[model samples]
Target: MDSWPHPQPLTNRLELVAVPRPVLTALVSGRAAAALPPPLVTPYLAGEECAGLWRMRSMQLSDKPGDAPWVTRFVVVPGVSGAVGAAGFHGAPDQVGMVEVGYRIAPEHRRNGYARQALEILLSVAGSSPDVRVVRASISPENHASRALIQQFAFAEVGEQWDDEDGLETLFEMVLRTQ
Candidate 1:
């Protein structure tokens, strides 16, 4: 358990909880089903996959240098109960000043404007850092909903990349206004 509290502040119907390695490990090992977080409803989008991704990100950050939070947070809706999904940065801003942001909301939580609000959290957090100048997001071309969510921001289609699972994905980039 982590003593430090670094939750993302939001002004909506949700809150962000830091998902530590232990919790993630349990989730992946199927132990969370018995003792999951109170706010997390049963069958939490099968977080096992996201936990695997989190482990990979953690390994990369540990093997490299610089400041990377390497933290995955759960989207908790207090009164409604249960975590909708997860969101966090890929890593700290690179030397070239680019940071990648990723997020996913459960199918049940979609169409409720949670994604847009969640994105506001990402943008605000990255913008608060002095070293971060640009935020990147890559989405599958067939994911019209995600594209629409990103369109709410000032992001532009910069390029594309091939993914093993998602195939060719369209990349969007946004330059943050740093003072």
Candidate 2:
């Protein structure tokens, strides 16, 4: 029932915020997609498939009340000197009080630690929320960069899952209780 807030600039290096449908449409249909890899194209093109993702992001920025429980998405736009990045929660903060996080850096933005920076921000935000007790990340077994980024957060290898839509992925979970 709580309304979400508008996008706010963070650390002068990124903006943790939600994006509207029109802007999402533009990003997917415009040159933005051109800067992403093949794996990100389908979700950008098929809004239906990404409806939950979009709604989560919307709710994060919405002022409307009585919104259902959902995950939040953030567009990681780097500061004046950096390129755009993308990241989001996988679903509503879970019943077990865990949330999953995912992210991608534009091909041009890789190797600059943006993914790690974004993950830290997300984890901090989620951890600060009373409803969130843990944060999880599922990455493809072969994605070394993703695995490495998550390791920096000290997320332990909990298990693996056979994603019907994504083949096999390794699931890592991290406790986010107050330090």
Candidate 3:
């Protein structure tokens, strides 16, 4: 990843803020600012659903040390400018080394290429990890932007699933090119 335009500094644009469950709980409780200090991007979303998911996962994945750092990350830009949104693995790889990915950019940051850049970084991480073989993203049919983003790589439509929160979702998957 040396070719990445942004320096490796933690505060650089397109930073990945690791939200371990404890950190996420702090963010939700307004204690993260003091506890974690600077450069750790917190959830900027007003949506309670996303916040709750972070809290719930904190307990669910508590025992899995590998998932704590990469499960959910805030996508920040402009060298500590702040979080524009988030992207991360839904969880650690399953028995077959498959993991799901999800990402969202803030409304104000749309069309800024932040989401794409963040997804690329995340994919790179997953691709290089020995534990991850496939990455999947579930998107609504109406989300043309999301569809286009995944298509930028070698991703393909593998299937669909029904979700209580999002209804029917089209599943896209990519076998990581590790070689």
Compare the candidates by TM-score and give the number of the best one. Answer: 1
Against the reference, the lDDT scores of all candidates come to: 0.70, 0.60, 0.72
Score every model by TM-score.
Answer: 0.82, 0.66, 0.78
For model 3, how does the per-residue alpha-carbon lDDT over 1-179 read when each residue is reduced to its tens digit? 11222333454457666655556677667565576545545445435546666665566576676666557777767654566787778888888888888888877778978878777777777877898888989999889999999899888999999988788899998887443
Worst 10 residues of 2 by lDDT: 1-10
The per-prediction tally of clashing pairs is 1, 0, 0
Better of 2 and 3 by TM-score: 3
TM-score of 3: 0.78
lDDT, candidate 1, 113-133, per-residue tens = 777766777777777888888
> Which ranges of candidate 2 are over 4 A from the true structure?
1-12, 25-74, 77-83
Scored against the true structure, residue 112 in model 3 reaches a CA lDDT of: 79
- What would the C-alpha RMSD of candidate 3 be, to one decimal place? 4.3
- In candidate 3, position 156 carries an lDDT of 94
Top-lDDT structure, candidate number: 3
Sorting all predicted structures by TM-score, with the top scorer first, yields 1, 3, 2
The TM-score that candidate 1 achieves is: 0.82
Stretches of candidate 3 off by over 4 Å are 1-13, 28-43, 63-65, 177-179
Model 2, residue pairs in steric clash: none
